[model samples]
Each structure stands twice: as C-alpha cells, then as structure tokens.
Target: MTATTSPRVGDEIGPLEVRATTLEDLVRWAGAIDDYSPIHFDPAAARDRGLPGVVVNGPWKAALLSRLLTDWLGESGTVTGLRCEYRRPDVVGGTVRARGVVSAVTRDGAYECVACEVWIEDGAGERTVVGTATLRTRRPETGGAPPADGHGRAALIGDRLRDALRVGAEAGRFTYRVEAGDLARFVHAVGGRPPAETVGTHVPPEAPPTYYAVLDPVERRELQLEELLDELPFAKTGGGNAFNEVEYERPIRVGDVLTVVTTYEEPYERDGRAGRLLFRVRRNDVFDADGHLVARSRMGHVLAYDLDRVAGR
Candidate 1:
C-alpha cells in the first residue's frame, strides 16, 4: 500500500486515482490522438446512434489502463505489451476506475518483469474494459511475425465483401515527430502527470506503451482504430473498436521521429450477443529515426449491420 511496496502476484494496483469523464477530456483526446470520432464529442450524434449519451473514447480507456500499470510500477517501469477489450460503454459524466493485480513476476538478468491483469470498472461495479499487460522495471533496449494470410473464418465472408476486402494491403505510411507536449496532453487527459507546459512538471523522457496509439495522425487519412478498415464500402458506415494489442521494442522518447507503416489483415465475421458482427484487423509497425522497430500494434474493430436492409435496397 506504500510507495516503497514491492508488487507480489496478488498485489492490487490502484483502482487508479481518477475523476469523472467529461466532454473536455474527450475533446482533448480527440485533438491529441486524432480520433475525432463524433460519438466521443457530439451528444447529438451519440443519440442518433441509439446511445444514451456521449461515451468515453475506447483509446482513452486503453491509455488509462496502461496508466494503471505504469503509475503503479513508477517512472522507471515500462509497459512491454498490452491487450485490452472494450467490454462495455462508459458514458461521459460517469466515473470509472482502473485497477489491476500482479499476475506474475520474474527476474531476467537486470530487468524485473511483471505481468498484470487490469480492468476498468464503473460505479455500478461493472467492468467496461478488461485486459492484461506485461511490464518491466529497469529498461533494456531492444522486440512479431505477421498475422497469417487468412486470419479469420473466410468461409463466413460474403463473396462480394470478401473479394472487395483488401487483406494484406498496405494502408499508408507517414512520418510523425514525437513531441513532449503531445505526450503531456495524452497523459494529462488520461489522468496521469501534469501538462508539460506547467512550470514545474518536466517533459517525460519516454512515453508509455499506449503512446503509439495516441500519436497524432496529422498526415494520414485513417485514424488509429480505423486504419485497416478504410476504403471498404461495407465499412464506410461505422463501427467501434473491439480490442487492441500492442508490443513495444523500446520506449518512444521525446524528439524521436517515427516512420509508421500500417497494413490490413484478413477480415472476418462472428456472431455476437447483439447480432452478426464483422471484424477487421489493422497492424501498425513503428520505426525510430534510426529505422529500428519501436512498436507493433494490432487493432480489432467490430462492425454490426443489417443485411436485410441492404438486400431490400
């Protein structure tokens, strides 16, 4: 419970000190990450979509989950890998907390590796996001094989949709300069350290694992969760991020220029509690100015629709 405490397998990470979600927080995230999906900002759009009100951004929650571990392990700690699922919607104006428990701890030479299972819970005691993360203390520099060609159930895919899908296609590539101010905004939006512009708070030397996802998409047409789904006619409607998995080779540091290339994996289908859902995956490979890999992230999105409505048309 103390700052000097050593995390054991059962030790609980903070139900991180957090505050209620707000419209301003969503706007900050949108500006910082380029995930300017209207559902996060416009309550009217959310209402039109049948949602009760504006909902928290899924990527924002993912950042908070990483914050739960990084904050617990202290600044020296680095998140090596993270995988989370958006299980439920957390509406704006509601308070949600992130918590985790150390699942495993091992020493690999100079680094102490810790694995944790983390989740976000609403005031009603329901989990809105759930996942696991692997972290390490005392960073060691230097990190996927590609997804199989046919990753999902191809048989279930409609011939027209299947043929139209751009599996294994390169979406886009661009260079993005890393800035401490952006990192500061992301961290502050997710309830971490104060803004870098603050008189006393210094710019973070390295960004947390989720930083790659929140990087500005200044030149790219597609946003983080929608990268792989772009250009598909069926996907033109809209969808929500289902899950995100990322692995880091090294922490992204301020002043580093990154060349990021993203590609599409196979598209698939699945039946869900609501209805038949379409799933798409996007993989992003980040390289430092030296051309070394920085991180690799695969994002999954679930798109629900009515075949009958289209067929009737």
Candidate 2:
C-alpha cells in the first residue's frame, strides 16, 4: 500500500490576522455568548478586584485558535484534537496575532499533520496563548483503516479531561464586569438584535438568548484556564501541546455578576501499540452574584511523551 504524503513540517501554511482585543470586543464576545460577568464589562468591579482591567474570556481564545486552524485547512480537514495553555490575561484594547507552524507530518498509509499555534503579543512580543492541533487529510477513498485504539482515544479523551480539571480548580473566585456599550457592539457583530432587558427599554425584563455568552457557567472555567496557563511555569517549556473542545450550557443576561469556580476531577493512563498515554479531567461550576448555580463545564486532555527520546538509550 502506498503511504499518503502531506505538507512538510515547518510549512508556513498562511498568516492569520489576530483580531485586536478591545473592551467592545470583550463585551461583544460576552454578549454574543449571553454572558453577564461584571469582570468582562464593569471597570469599577475590575478595579476593585485588582486586575489591570476587564479581561477577555478563555474560550474566546480557543475559538480564535480554532478559527485559525479551520481557515488554514479549509473545510476538508478533520480536526483530530486541540489543546491550549492560556499563558497570560489579554487585556482589552491590545493587538494580538495568531500564528501557526507545521510541526510534523506522519503517514502510515494515511496523511496527518501536527501544527503549533500561539496568540502572540502584537506590540510586546509575548505569547498569551499556546496551542497544538492535529488534523487528518479528508481523503474519502482511504477506507477500512484500523480503528483508533486505546492510545488514540485516550489522547483525545484525556485532553478534554485536563481542560475540565484546570478550569474547575482556578475559575472560582475570579470575577468580571460587563458594560452597556460592550453589549451593543457584540449584538451587532453576531447579527443579534438588542433585547428589552439589554437596552433597558419597554420590553419584558428577560435576557436575550445570545447574552448568556457572558454569564454562562462554562465561561468561568474558560477564564480560569487562561489564568492558570498565564501562571504555569511549564508554559515556557516551548514544545508541549495544547487543545480544546467547548460546549455552552445556557443563556446569560446583562447586569448580572458571575462567579466561577473550578475543580480537578481525575486522571487516567493507558497503554497502546504506539506507546503509553495519560489523560486528565476537570470540572467547573458557575454562579451568579445572588449565588445561584448557573452552569457546569467538563474538559479533558491527553499528553503523549516521546518514548524514544525519553529512553536515551
């Protein structure tokens, strides 16, 4: 059988414009997702909390990375996995760039490529988000391949678990404030109309469905991962990988304060024909200012150590 060939490692692929982060951007992001976190909008609450200012949400960063990969590979490639380490809090109103580099091309009669990405500091030359992604070419004719075994499945499942655990452990006690203008812009960008609750007008006092992006429970865990990666010492180790998979729970509205807390759930390991694999899981709990439970998030992650290199024989 002839092996499929793909792009070489270190291929540039293409350049992606990292959208600038702004107060308006954050608000729109929150509004689009229906989140009402004070930290995302309310400057006073942010100052009270001692952050430089309102911070961008974490999942948004993941989305940005996903956007980059999807754009580059077009619609034909399948995203096998993604992992992210939110290395720093990206303050609103700063320029950021998303960059990717092909790291490896492997074929066992099928072609696959691994790429690394980062949301780099546009002006300061720092990296705020680090990620790794795996993609398989969309060749439809290559049928009847062996099923991915315990090792492959563990890698996929473990990455999600780790993300859930990290979010659960660090997202609680974090706060965000959202402002009015922020809401307006986000609604506009996502093609959403202002709701009565959001515009403070003569409509029913209910939040628009889209506003939950700001206050959704998963948002808390999303933000927590950003904070954790920003502080992780291993973040600078430079060759580790990152990925993400996200799901939204419910809608959020304006004028709501969000409180997030995350917990590390569990870890598992498995052996495969290729090598050994490790997986981790996390859970996040979200709440409103009134202390009502809002949402929950679970995430997983997988780590693969290069056994040949580690053996040093």
Candidate 3:
C-alpha cells in the first residue's frame, strides 16, 4: 500500500545493510551510467595520482539514499524532492548503511510528511551523504477519488510550472580534498581510466577528465526546498507544490573544488483542460578550481494539482 497507511513517524521504515565494497560493484555502477575513469581499476595509477586507494562515486550514494526512502515509503509513494551534499568519498571495501527517521508531518486536511534527514554512514559512523525528502499519501477512504476541493487539481498543475517565474542568482563555493581511493571508486563506477601514460593505473598521472565524479567542497549537501518554495511567489498563491526532473552534466573528479551558481531564468503560464498551468526554468553552472566552466544544466518544474491525472488515467 502506502507509507501513509502506516500512520506513525518512529516506526522503522527499512534498513540497508552493507557488505565489502567490491571493484565489480563500482564498475557496474559507473558503466551502467556510462561513466568511465581509470582510477577505479589501476592501483599504480591511483598511487601516482596521490590517493590511498579507490573512491566511490558521490551520486551512487545519493541513489542509495533515494532507494532507501522509496523502499521504505512503499511502491505507491513518489519522491517529490531530493537534495544531497557530498561530504567525503566512500572508499572500496568500506561498509556503509542508509538510515531514515520520520521528522515532521504537514496536515492540511490531508496528511503529507517530511523526513528531516536521511543519511549514509560509513563503518566508523562517518556520514557521506546528508539530505532530506518529502512524500504524499492519498486519504484512506477516498483512494483514487477526486479531491474534496475542485481547486486541488488546478493547484497541483499550477505549482509544477511556477518555477518559470523566479528571477535572480544564487551562488555557493565548496572545496574538497581528493584521495586515491575516491578516484579509483569513481573510475570503477564510470569505467576506464582518466587517460594516462600507462593502462591499468588506478590513478591518473596527470589531471583527470572534466567528467570525473570528484567530491565537492561541501561536506554535507543541502536540499533547500523550503528556500526554493519561498523564493517563487507563485508557489505561495496555490499552496506551494512542485516537481523535479534532474540530469547530470558531467562527472566530478577527486580533490577538485567546485563552485556552484544557480539562477531563475524565466517563468510562464499555460492553460490546460484541468485549469491554468505554470512552468519555471532554472540554470545551474558548475566550475572547477581554476574558475573554469565545467558543466551546465537546466531544470524545469511543473506546478499543478492534477499531476497524476495529467499523466493520464
């Protein structure tokens, strides 16, 4: 059924147990996503590149966190929002666990819950990925029924597209140290070395590729949905609602500091069968240590109440 069906916060949602982090696991993760860097495989290369051992991809940890939440909430639950900060590299052979605790519930006639924090911890109790999320469940008696207020459908649609109205810039700078293990894990996950004098070298002898998945300066990633919701005026008009569609621009390498800057470029409104729909567009720029542009990404959010219905029954 659904997480809301349970109706309690402290209840144990689920647990992710960890075993030895293997090279094969790393390779499979990166290859599946088409990321290939040498540090994951060659020990000598890793040594030359100045890492203790192999490192794991930061996004993999984020994915694990996402899985933990979805599995705990049940198949019916949808991930409304997710924001992760990469603190430190998870090395090969290190054990980690993903855990969650119910933090708060927002009941506006119907119940919607927010998990304040979900984290991934290493064997020594060190956190790798720190983040938060939100989930919505249908009211029990009216499963699949229309909302009590006809405006619900229109509201959901409006919120999803409200991002287009935002205007201004948000910027932050983060620094992180690169270790050999971090590079190796990233290599295994994405596949291939960072282009080196010798094949099979775990670390690259020279600078790594722009697509390498390096640790950013911030130890804990922040998912500021509250701030984002506050910044956009449309979000306030119809009961703040939005949805995310994320895409990776490139891989981040180890020991590289990244400066992330974001801006609200445009906002637009459209009319649909349900009612009025709003759309918001935002852009993110990622820069390397030398202040050079590494990658750019654009994200759009759809604001509306009839999200499920719009998808088609």
Candidate 4:
C-alpha cells in the first residue's frame, strides 16, 4: 500500500462500486472544468455525431482512475504519473466501475513506489478507459522560452498542417494560480472529500489528480484550432479528447502560480473504424513561479474532419 505496508506486484486496488453518472453530475463537472460540450448533456447533439447517446467526460473517467490509485494508497502516498486512453465511449445513464492491479513495486530513495494497470469498465464488462498510474510517498518540490512566435504558422495549415505540427511548433504559453475554491468544487464534482480551509489559510490535503487539465488546455491554445478548416480541402467531423499522459514533479499545493508552455509534436495519421484519422499531439510543460518544473503533460486529440473528405471523395 505504501512506505508503511508493502504493496506487492499483483495486489489489487479496487473494483470501485459500479456507479452511474447522472446528468447533474456531468453539469457539476462541466462547471468545474473545461469540458462543457452539448455532446455531454444533450442526446440529439450526440446523435448528430453518431454516438448512441450523451457520453461521460473522458477526463472525468481519467480522474476516476486516479481516484482508484489514491483511494488504495490512503494519505500515505500521491500519484506521480498517470496515462489514460479512451478506447471506447461510455454513454450517460450507464454504469462505470474502476479497478487496478499493482504491476510493480519498488523503493525510490525514501519513498516506496508502485505502478498499477488500471481501467474503467462498462456494464458489459468491456474496458472504456485504460491506463497506468505511478504512486509514491509524497516528496518535496522538484522550462524555457516560448517557442518561436506562431503568427506566421497559420499559413502552414491544410497541405502543410503536417509542417505546422512539426516537433517544437510552439502553441503559446498560459499562466494560472491554483485557487482553493476551484479545487474544492472540482473535488466535490468528482465525489471526493476536499480539505477544509482554516481562517485565511487553505492548502488541500493533496491536489486532485486530474486538476492538471485546468492548466493544459492543449487543443484550445494559441493555434485556435476551430478557426482553421475554413477551406473545402477537408470538412470538419467528429473529434474530441483522444488520450492524456501527465507526470508531476510534486503534488501541487494551493496558491502555486504556474505557467504552461505548449508545443505541437508527433502529428500523424492513422486508420480507425470509420476511416482515416488525423491525430495532433501537444506537450504542455508547467513551471512554478520560481521556474521549477511542476508538471509536464502530453495530450492527444482526434482532430475533427470528415473521413470521406480525407479520402478525397
């Protein structure tokens, strides 16, 4: 379990109770974070996109997987890394269960550590989100200039979208200070108990695992992806979060001001069940006010475009 009790390989974390997420729950989450699309709460909007119905938030699912790890570690440890992919969508009104099994356990200096393979499953017992998490006893605290300016990058879209996505293509940097009120609302939306504030002091017992999303905002960065696709070369189609991998230098305490520098990297095309898929990858590096690397996040998105248009139909 931690530095106290040995967590051996193959030890299980949970089969957290299969719980159905309600529309209100999704609203609470949407209000707390950036994922507020009609596809999350409107059935017709989902049907227009070929989904069976309204779907649960992918980041929310990632948070649930993180909870599985923290719930197992108790207060003795914190998750240092987590990576998850939404293999399949989970529709609203359906049940989701989380479980993890320790795959490796070792010692990192003074902290004991373990890695677990975790996933969320649907009622049919099929995995909807699958990933791995790394946990260690909390450790003490652990970027660079913004990439070359991006104003000239817009001319590089479409035929040269690949060029625009070349490694190190700067997407711009953003800054935010962690607020206890924001953290509390996010924790409650995910059904976690938030730490209480005393007088004017407010430090969470631990930062919520997936709160890093608030800092990244990868797809919506300087590129302003939506303003693209104005031409007939490719028509916009279905696209949203594809996956996310985050590594923390330390659990972010309240009031830490962070600036994240984002850049495009490893853009490529692959074939999915529908047809050709375009994947755009971004890396966000977060630094504290003192310029210490607080966290780094790499996020993948299924860029919206019609499959037929991509096929030259």
The lDDT for every candidate, in the order shown, is 0.73, 0.57, 0.57, 0.75
The stretch of ten residues in a row with the least summed lDDT in candidate 3 is: 211-220
Model 2, residue 70: displacement in angstroms? 0.5
Candidate 1 lDDT at 32 equals 69
Stretches off by above 4 angstroms in model 1 are: 1-5, 139-313
| Runs of candidate 4 exceeding 4 Å displacement | 1-159, 162-167, 192-205, 219-226, 230-232, 235-237, 304-313
Clash counts for the predictions, in order: 0, 62, 61, 1
TM-score for predicted model 2 compared with the true structure: 0.42
Q: Tens digits of per-residue lDDT for model 3 on 13-58?
A: 4458576678887787775665666667666766677876787777
| Residue-wise C-alpha lDDT for candidate 1, range 114-215, written one tens digit per residue | 889999999887999999999877643321222368634222334434344445766667788888777776676676433544546665779877787764
Worst 10 residues of 1 by lDDT: 138-147
Per-residue CA lDDT of model 2 for 1-313, tens digit only, reads 1123345677764445555677777776875777767888887887788878877777777787777777666544667788888888777776666777888767645455555544544547677888788877654344243356653322223355466445335634555544555556556445555454446433323444545444434443344333322222221212222333334454455555667565665566575443455444555466777787766655555554444442322
Clashing pairs in 1: none
Measured by lDDT, the strongest candidate is 4
Q: Which digits, one per residue and each the tens of the lDDT, describe model 4 over residues 8-116?
A: 8888888885478889778777776745589999999999999999999999889888877877766667899999999999998899999899898888887768788
Q: TM-score of each candidate?
A: 0.44, 0.42, 0.42, 0.45
